[model samples]
Target: MNGPRHRIFSPITRAGRASGQRGAAVFVVMLVVTLLTGLGIFAVRSASLSTMASGFNRQLTQTHYVADYAVLAMVGELGLNAQVHSTNMTSGGSTQCVGFAELVAADKTPSCAQYGYGELNALAQTYSSQELLQPPTGTYPATVVPGSLGASPLEGDMRIEVTDWHPAWPILPGNDATKGQLGYAMVTVSAIGLVRPNPTGMAAGTWDTASATAAGVESSRAHVVLGPILMSN
Candidate 1:
């Protein structure tokens, strides 16, 4: 019995060690799978957010262009000495024409197209400036243009107004009647321009409505000087 019995290896101990090792390996694999899943979800969410931001930016730019065009068109109509009827005038004085006209002696009236330019009104003279800034109330009914706004499926409608108007030069010389006949007077006017989104891509006035423009609407208020048009007798 003597010479120290050599320690014998226990199968149970060896089996326990192997089982613990297998448990650790399984836990590591599960952790790796969970991490991969988390990464995939994060990537997908980032992509979705990016797409949404891109879309919004595109829409904003479109609105800006539409508004700019509205301003240009309005200028073309008023700045180039376009003929206007008194009944057709919407904003200015009800009886003064925009173009040059002689003051008729019989009627004691300036011989204008129809009426004088509407008084130079303040900003947002036509629509509520507050409501024009946000969604829901910001959008307005599409105005009919004589022709297309340009391009297909992308054309939009517009809203424009004259925010300020007045004579820019050649002031009447202390009511001098003689000067009126010999001298000429110039006039300048201000205007505002806006545009709305048309999802249906239909022609102006055909599908444009207040309710339809309640969303995705954009507005622009511009103080544009039409010019010193020659008004003379």
Candidate 2:
């Protein structure tokens, strides 16, 4: 029997195998971490978008309410006097009454005639003499003054504008020289209400000059045809 055979060992090969196993484990962990991070980012973005949409909806609703109030105010004023061309009243009397003639004429003249029978005719003639003069007062019965539907808590960015007031006449055929004309004094009123950008980063584009004019004309025409108060956000 010879001396006990010494078992041969390969240290380098064993160490190399162990190192490969460790690298594989590290790669798996890194992949899992990357996937989790991507999922977290997607969730955050979704939440932000949802919040923005909700805020936008709320602002839109508030703007619509304000617009509706303005339309109602205009209609009430018109109901007081269908023939009255224009009248404006502000809250707490802070603003003076603005009438159609004042808006159109460069120089507005005050009436000197007292309220009476013959004086009424004289006043009508005086007003008729001026191309921009409005219809005589008392032609439209006085009604309750409208209150301010200010944009306060909802959104501080709101505006109202009265665009046009005119008569609604039936279109006459060019060929018909003896056509009977049907006419009615149509009071066209237009207003705009806006809601400021919400905290959630949802904001609508501001109405530019052209857009405002177009919207005013469209709204006036719609209300004239419908004969009802119109509102929009």
Candidate 3:
């Protein structure tokens, strides 16, 4: 009998097996590369969003501080009895009322002398001779002083409004409800603060359109009610 037949493995079969293995390895490498790229993109986007949120928060806080400060500054400027050069309403080049408190309830009549008496006429003598307080009218831009709020790189400006508080009173059977609360006066203060790019070389009391349209600008507003200052005849 011939020696037991020995089967020899063909080179083609072995080569085919090696080729299949190589293909599988290439697929694994490609998948790993794609996953790594996806992860990198996600990380970059998350970081960018976090940075933007942080900037917004900082700007908002600074603006709020500026608004509150503006309100307080205005109160100081007007004091309690200083005469205001009110441009909102005037007759004969002067307001009908004599004092800031008096103006609270002064009528907007065509004639300054129509209102028989102003609200706080009793206290007019307190600051009767003081110079008229010339305040800016409407909403006007204000400057931010450097180093005022410590070592802050942030810069900003503000606008403020002051006016009489006309409180509506509940009508009673025997009352002149239209006159509102008599023997008392009140004032309303409103302020808006804005955070924008530094106005380093800009002229005082002036803001350019570029700064006004800049991105990431932030703002805050404050509204406050001041006083029921007692009034007497």
Candidate 4:
């Protein structure tokens, strides 16, 4: 009987081994690609949210400024009144005015000739003169009239109110009435402002009319109230 013959097996070939390794490498590359894609998507979402928050904050800030400006304008008008002693007017006795047209007209200046500030001021002056001359019959002894302050875009709506007028607390003795004592007046004004989106894709949403309509980007009602004695004594 012949001795058991041993068949010699060749060692694994380098080319074959390399081919198998290549397959595994491809799988690893695919997995990395998938992970990177997922991260990219998450980054995009986070950025979008941040942008939206920033836009909303800006809008709110603008609204507050608009309201404040309106109240200040009304205060200026009240201050211009010669008959009312700046210091001694009672809160409840102060007047209130509302009207979008009137407000827009009054806001105009010579530099804003196209906006018609002159006409608006004339109208307001006339109205104020009349109101002061006639005075009110009520016990509170104040008038609430409607007048325009300046010219605003047709889309803008504005309203103003003066209130909280009262004789100064801790009235000083020996104060002359002719000069008028210090008095307080409160003013509230509301306005809406529109914002347009960036055209170059720096911000979300487009500047088109459709985007504006969808976002409801119009300004909200702005209100400001002045407290304490405003009129002079």
lDDT of 3: 0.47
**Better structure of 3 and 4 per TM-score:** 3
The positional error of residue 2 in candidate 4, measured at the CA in angstroms, is 18
Looking at model 3, residue 73 earns an lDDT score of 54
Q: After superposition, how far is residue 154 of candidate 4 from its true place, in Å?
A: 12
User: Model 4, 134-181: lDDT tens per residue?
Assistant: 221322214433222112111212234333333433434554444353
Ranked by TM-score, top first: 3, 1, 2, 4
lDDT of 3 by residue, 92-135 (tens): 43244333435536554331211111212222334474221111
Superposed model 3: Cα runs more than 4 Å off: 1-9, 85-146, 149-153, 165-184, 199-210, 213-233
Superposed Cα deviation of residue 32, candidate 3 (Å): 0.9
TM-score of 1: 0.49
Given candidate 2, what's the lDDT at residue 42? Answer: 97
How much does each candidate deviate from the true structure in C-alpha RMSD? 12.8, 16.6, 11.8, 16.6
Candidate number of the best TM-score: 3
Which scores higher on lDDT, 3 or 4? 3
Please provide TM-scores, in order, for all candidate models, with all chains considered together. Answer: 0.49, 0.47, 0.53, 0.39
Per-model lDDT: 0.44, 0.40, 0.47, 0.41
Q: Which has the better TM-score: candidate 2, or candidate 4?
A: 2
lDDT of 2 at 231: 15
Off by over 4 Å in 2: 1-9, 81-84, 87-153, 170-184, 197-233
